[model samples]
Target: MENATPSRTALGVARMRALHQFSPQAGLFRDPYAIAILGEAAPAAQELEQEDERRQRMRLFVASRARFAEDWLAAAVLRGVRQLVVLGAGLDTFSLRNPYRDLSVFEVDHPATQAWKRKCIADSGLAEPAATRFVPVDFERQSLSAELAAAGLQSTAPAFFIWLGVVPYLTKEAILKTLSWIAGVPGSEVVFDYSEPAANRDAAGQAALAFHAARVASVGEPWISFFVPAELAISMGELGFDEIEDIESGDIAARFSEAPKGMTNNSGGGHIIRARRTA
Candidate 1:
């Protein structure tokens, strides 16, 4: 993520999400604003037509992770949580499509990315929801806790955080620091995704991982962290989260029954996890 430019990987993720809208498995996760939010930047018909197995898998995984996170968020709302924080919110539309009238959404992201997203939203003629507040912070140079606090996050109230497409790019120390801050807020719950070590993946999976990793690295955002699921759960437990739900890449398709026929589970080491601080 360059200081003056939006993240390249962020743009790619948004494109994948937009492509998912045209997929047969669109029923797996319905994001009406996904395509609209991209404005002219949305993938062209040709791009959608040329999709391969890898692209299909990546598209579905991105959609499925959001579905899983929002499903948990709905459950949290039922349990009386009123605040929703989207960490590393790269063109995420949950804030725009928020169904809960009382839920306050805080979108935390890099300054440049947030600015670009704001412009995109305005250009697309989408109404910025009254519940949404944008918080800009450079993860490497600024403090998330401080930025979120300044943005009016209630430290005393429980908040549900959806951190997608972000964990693997951060160092272990940074990941734990953010989790620790979340843990300090009682009854808070968070959903995030992470990857296992490349060695844990099958040969084909390894190749795919390498390809994507190199692509992101070429843009200066290299993958720096990988966590073993069991170890991550243990770390979460120590950080004061009492409940943890970890889903592997291979199990995502099964969780969403409407997934298309060709969308088979990849043998990749990716995972999506939800951890709750119940104290």
Candidate 2:
């Protein structure tokens, strides 16, 4: 993953499309660029076509996550925070599907991924959101703050960053440094997801996480960090976020859970943390 190319961007989008196939009401998202953003070389897509059950689960995951990210962005904009940044942009469509009408949005990712995304959207005749800008940085070579500044970001602006399905791939130092950067900014907030620590692995847990780990490794990416939800809150506070909430994995699924018996853990899940900077 250190040396990436645009091809991986296409792969990322393909994963989303494969997963979205599970949602019976995907059209509700109305993100026209879904197919356009992901392109053709998706490993997940190929896997889904071969296995019906995998496809179904993928769709459910995507639908749930889409709901979370979209709702969070809408709320952030409603709250009057004008700047939104997406780290490890992957194939997320929030910039294209801006629920907030008047906010500045940045999509930051590796150069290969950013280029692939831009070209795909453009080739598909999908125009970027009028308020959107791209910020490409080599996570291995450049400092995130410096790269963002070059892309016209101001540290003083109260910003909201969305980082979904990304934390597990970042090192502990990298994650903490990034958080501290946001904390240094007088008033910034961010939402991201992290994997639970490996110590909690049960038979079910081990299998599920194993599949995920295998998938990432197949694509040259590795899971580098994990957090205990309780520890995550304390770490966030120490790094400068005043509030940290561990949103249950089933929180979003409960909103659309079909089982009257209620939600069950789906292998692994994320923490929907909305941390704010006060100092």
C-alpha RMSD for every candidate: 1.3, 3.1
Q: Clash number for model 2?
A: 3
31-143 in candidate 2: lDDT tens per residue?
A: 55566565564334345456454334444554555566667667767777888889888777778867567788889888887887788777767887889889987665679
List residue ranges in candidate 2 displaced over 4 A.
2-4, 7-10, 18-22, 25-30, 39-59, 257-263
Global lDDT scores for all candidate models: 0.88, 0.68
Please tell me which predicted candidate would have the highest TM-score against the true structure. Answer: 1
Counting only residues 3 or more apart in sequence or on different chains, how many pairs clash (N, Cα, C under 3 Å) in candidate 1? 0
Worst lDDT run of 10 residues, candidate 2, spans: 257-266
TM-score (all chains, Cα) for each model:
0.96, 0.85
